[model samples]
Every structure is written in C-alpha cells, then in structure tokens.
Target: MGADPTAIVVGLGLPSDVGTGWLDDLTDGFRDECDLVGAGVAGGDTTRCDLVVISVTALGDLGGRAPVTRSGARPGDVVAVAGRLGHAAAGLALLESGHEGLPGPDGRRRDDPRRDDPRRDGRAEPYGSDERREDGVAGLVGAHRRPRPPYPCGPQAAALGATAMLDVSDGLLQDLGHVARASGVGIALDPGAFTVTPEMERVARLLAADPLDWVLTGGEDHALAATFPAEVRLPPAWTVVGRVTGGEGVQVSGRTVGQGGWDHFRM
Candidate 1:
C-alpha cells in the first residue's frame, strides 16, 4: 500500500543480457503491460544468469478498502469470473505442433517451418495455413505469451460487495480450490458458463483435447475470479459462473474435482 492508497509499487528483477536490446524490449514490455492496469515500477535489481528469469514484487493498494482474501467467501455468495479462459493452453498446442505462426515482437518476423523445415519436407503445420495474425489464432498466441489481466475488475468487484476475490493464475479450479479451502466453503461450478473462444475450440479439435479441461486446468490466463453477494448486481465485466455451496471442496456440475491445482513442489 502507498500513501496515495491507490498507487502500487512494483519491483522487477531482470537477467543480465549480453546485448542491451533484450533488456530494452523487456523494459518497454514491463512498462506497457504494467501501465495497461495502472501500475508503475518503483525500482529493482538486475543480474547475469544463463537464461531470463524475472522476479517481480508488487505491493497493491486497496484505496482504504478492506482487502479481499481467499477466506471471505460464504456459502450463499455467487461465483463469478471476469474475461475469457482456456486460450493460453490452446496457444501452447499451436506452438508445439510447428503451427508456431506467432509473429516476433511487434509483428515483424514470420517463419513458415513447414516450408523450411528440412525434416518435414514442406509438410504443413498441424493446423492448416491460417497462422496469419488476421486468422484469429493471434489472440490465443498473444494471450499465452503476454497475459493482460482484468486489473480494474478487482477493485470494481470489491466495490460491488464481493465477498471474496483472487486472480486466476493457476488453473481456475485450482485457484478456486484455494478460496474454498481458505473460506471453509464449497464451490460449485457450471461448465456451461465458461467463455470458450473459437480459437480454443479449433485448437482443441486439432489436439483431441477437451476445451473444458483447458478452462478448468489451464493456467496463466490472469483473469479475476470472485464471489459476490448473491443479491448484488454484478457489473458488466463480471460473469456469474457458479455459486458458493455447503461442502468442503469444489464440485463442477455434479462431480467433486480432485486435488488438481498446480503445485511447484510436486511438479
């Protein structure tokens, strides 16, 4: 928290680069991405490393509002999520199958590995020829590499009488599980309520993957998930995906979700 109550201080740690260009690009991205949600970098340190490893510390201000935590949810609150989900995992599928039509920074570089890969001999990428930016895959690709969080929605939900809130960094169910465990309440999710984009569906078909799995298990979407009072009218940015219920864990539809959240130590 800052003296201004709305200002946040961010500290960034960057790997040392042999060339100044990568550092410059990272700095610009940090500035632009942070500013996208009204955050500013205070200061930090840089050091040499074998690969780029960035550690960021953010001190957020709640503008004098009580902090919304995982423990605030209640059995009668309505569950909600802001923004889309599942595209990041789909984008990973495209990149892995040589459909990596993702353009280089600022849309300058384009590589057709199908036409150039000596091993494949002109075999097209797994997903057919539409890697171009206009083909709609760009949304998934960009979101995976550079996530845009629904920053304003956090405070907005808080103001709207939300009972609990958290960022969906890990898989949705996994993060929601945290809230459920912390609040000592159970969560019931409606799979039908998730917003599945066309690109996500397309990639899911190609990979023989379930888009619902991605929506539930995919990480890095950075969407805000919260529980508001059942009677409070959520703002336009919020989507009620489920409800708080009596139980000790999360259940989607009628099935209990196993302990499937991300764990770095276990992985």
Candidate 2:
C-alpha cells in the first residue's frame, strides 16, 4: 500500500514556500502530528528545466475533536494575538533600500565618537550599540523572508474557552475587521497598547515612515489572533490588543479603520 493521494494534495497546498527548504521544515515540523501522507517533486525537460513543481497532501484523524472555522467569532470577546508584528514589513523596506543595518533613533551613528575632535565633548553617547542594531535588522529580515506561526497558540485558545480565532495574514486592522464582520460586531484597538519594538522603530525612522503605521498596516505576520471572554485569563504570550463590540464594523480609536489586506489584484 502507498500514501493517500488526497493527503499529498493537501500538503502541497499548505501555506508555505513550495520548492524551498521551507517545505522540508514544514514537513519535519508536522512529523509527529500525522504521517507525511504523500510528497512529490518534479522538474525537467529534454533541454533544460526552468521550473520546479512540488505536490503534497496531508490527512489526519480528528481523534474525536470538533472542527473550527472562520465564522465562529462572537461579540463581547476580547481580541488578542500571539506573535510579533511589523518586522516583515520593516525587513522588506531595508532589503529594497539596500540598507545594511537596522533602523534606529534619529541622529544616531554606528561608530563611537572621536575623542580628539574639537567639536566633540569627548563624552560617550549612551545610545544603543552596534550589536543591538544588527540583531534588529537580522530579525526583521528573517520575519520578511519567513514568518513563524504560533501553531500551538490556536489550539491553546480553543482549549482556553475562546469564542473565535484567526491567523493574522493581513494587516492587524484588516484581519480584525474580518472577525468583526463575521461576528456581527465592531472592534476598537488602542494605539498606545501597540508598541513598536526598538528595531522596528529604527527601520521606520530610516524609511521616514511612521512606526504606528508599520505596526497597524503590516501583513504576513502569521500570528494567531483570537477572541476570548473578557474575564478569561489570557496566556502570557498573548497580547490583548482590542475588544469586540456589538456594533457592525471595526474601528481604531473611534475612527473607522480601513481594510488593507493582501490583495494580489490591487498589487
């Protein structure tokens, strides 16, 4: 007997890089959950193979569990997320602009001050070090190229009596809008609650972009966004970014937030 064809098809359709090493990582990552099911890669022609194609499928037993879907959200739930934001967007900006280091506060320089310069006070500046900037840039680049999803977070939310859940593939505002529309509710996000990490703030400054915009508008984060009871004890990793209301749409700071999700057509 061989692996099931349906399983192979499903695996290939999973949301990850197709031919890249990411596929292997994904396979290995899910090794314990279900058997690989099936996998195949094909490439080549009589002359030269210009393209590679891979097909995979996966199948799993429910183990007597209920299924979940996008329409399960409800009003009065506390909206939360598990994962970092804006790193990928900041990384893409750095890569496109050919910037070598992470973004930083205005007027800061990488090298230490020269001691003997007449214009210098000869005092060491107490700003961030080079290592911190480098780490920030590297993290942003990794986020852009490959986002790590909180796979366990979703299951944990369900187990913790969550009313709804979703993956943040679009901008935070846009994904929240989906939940709001689905649950027949509205959402309000606190701008102050969303903090930009140091590296992201630097990148935003370098690009002359607003750090808040980057945090709200960035997509491809792959973080798990979920809604739980207002009184529920949220996990430490989860951040309570917003709240669901009984209204019909979504808002940020009392203003109607726009939907700017991933749209290949618009691009």
Candidate 3:
C-alpha cells in the first residue's frame, strides 16, 4: 500500500551482557534512519533476553488514497520495479565468502561489510586482494548492510493507478508469487530486463556464482514491484520487467523457475 510513514514503535529484547554504549549506538542508528523518512520514534519497550531481538512497527497515513493490494492485479497489466534488484543479495554473498570489514584502497573502512556474515571464525580469506576488486566488493557489501528502499515511489505508483504493489523483501520471484497467487493471475518476467551491474558481474566471477541468480532470487533490497495498466506512463525510476497474464504463478522468460528464494523454514 502507498502511505506516508509517520511514527515507529520499537521493542528490544537485549542481553544482560550488552553495554550501554551499544544501546546508545543502536538508538542513534534508529533515529538516523527514521529521520531520513520524516518519521520519529514514538517510544518503545525493552526487556532482558539471552540474545538481542528488535521488533519495529511503523504507522502511516494513506492521505485519502485507497490501499493497493496484491489481489488487484489484472491480466494485461505491466509489471515494473522501482529501485535496485539484487545488490543486497550480492553483498550477502560477499560476507558469506568472508569479506566483511575489509579496508578499501585508501586503507579506510569505506568498504566495510557487516550484519550478514556469521562465519567470523577467522577461517575464511578475503576475496578482494586488488584495488579494483576491493572497490567492487565493498560496494556490493554496502548494499547488504544499508539497503535504501525507494520510499516515495510507493505513493507515486499508487497515484499512477497501480493495480497491485509490493516490496521485494523476500526475493523478486517469491514476493511476486504472492501477488500472482493473490490476484489469481500469472506473471511472465523477462530476465533480460534486469541489469547485471558490473560490480555484481565481477563479484560473481570471483565467487564462481551466477549473477542472474542474485537478480532473480536474492532478497532484502526492498525494491518496489507493482502492476499497472499498460498505457500508464511510469517514471524513470520504474523499470518494466514483465506483464500479468491470464493464468496463475510466476514465470521467467516464458519458463517456470525452480524454488530458489529465501525461506526461513527451509533454512
């Protein structure tokens, strides 16, 4: 749905061993992010737990506009996306390959990677040994840690008569599957429509991975995917990827894809 966020409520389950400085930094980061979208922290609750847990709820106003739902998509509508496609997933791959917090060419933390890698056992070697590779790796890693969602585009899409809309939080294929199932229609995507950034190509080459896999199945970028009438003139920020069809489920390049997205239960 297209709405303006106004406030956020947080709930923290922190460990007893955590330091006050750590709490201060966490709150400060929250404030900084909220400020970017003109939202404020309306207060929250905290409790002791064995591990750190954060829960956030955002409140928004639709400004008299009707809420866009996944079920509203219709056949012949064009499918488009606003913002990035697979930067976050590529970043996560770098972290898993043990390339977090690696210094840049200037020996600065400008390319620091954090938040996704868990194999911090000092056993994995860095992937980027040269300046060019290091810069590309850092850019991809930054995307994972600091995903910037296209906030304003949500409302703009709705204003342009979007029939269905959703954020690509759980992979493009997975999230769009929800829309397709809900709308009782099929979504046919064009793989060539997605751009394979140079950074992504470089990292994938080094890691022996497929860059297109990241674009199709990687999640957490928070890009907006919406369906609109074919005649609608979309803004430059939006890229047309596919179209809604008369059947059910989602396909890529006219063929059905396998299950390859993030699934908490499967993980």
Off by over 4 Å in 2: 1-63, 101-134, 259-267
Q: List the residue pairs that clash in candidate 3.
A: none
lDDT string, candidate 3, 13-124, tens digits: 9999999987876787677667767889998899999999999998888999999999999999999999778888988897898755554446666433342321222222
The ten-residue window of minimal lDDT in model 1 covers: 121-130
List the candidate 3 regions with Cα displacement exceeding 4 Å. 100-135, 258-267
lDDT accuracy of residue 96 in candidate 1: 76
TM-score of 2: 0.66
lDDT of 2 by residue, 1-267 (tens): 011212223213333334557555554433322222222322212222334333433343333445444456666778787877777777777777777443334544333212111113322122122124334556576567555555556557776777777777777777777877777788877777775887777677778867776667688767777888898999787899888877766666777765443231121
What are the per-model numbers of colliding residue pairs? 0, 11, 0
Cα TM-score per model: 0.80, 0.66, 0.85
Candidate models: Cα lDDT each:
0.70, 0.59, 0.79
lDDT tens string, model 1, 68-110? 8889899989999986577777766677776666443366444
Which regions of candidate 1 deviate over 4 angstroms? 1-17, 102-135, 260-267
Between 2 and 3, whose TM-score is larger?
Answer: 3
Ranking by lDDT: 3, 1, 2
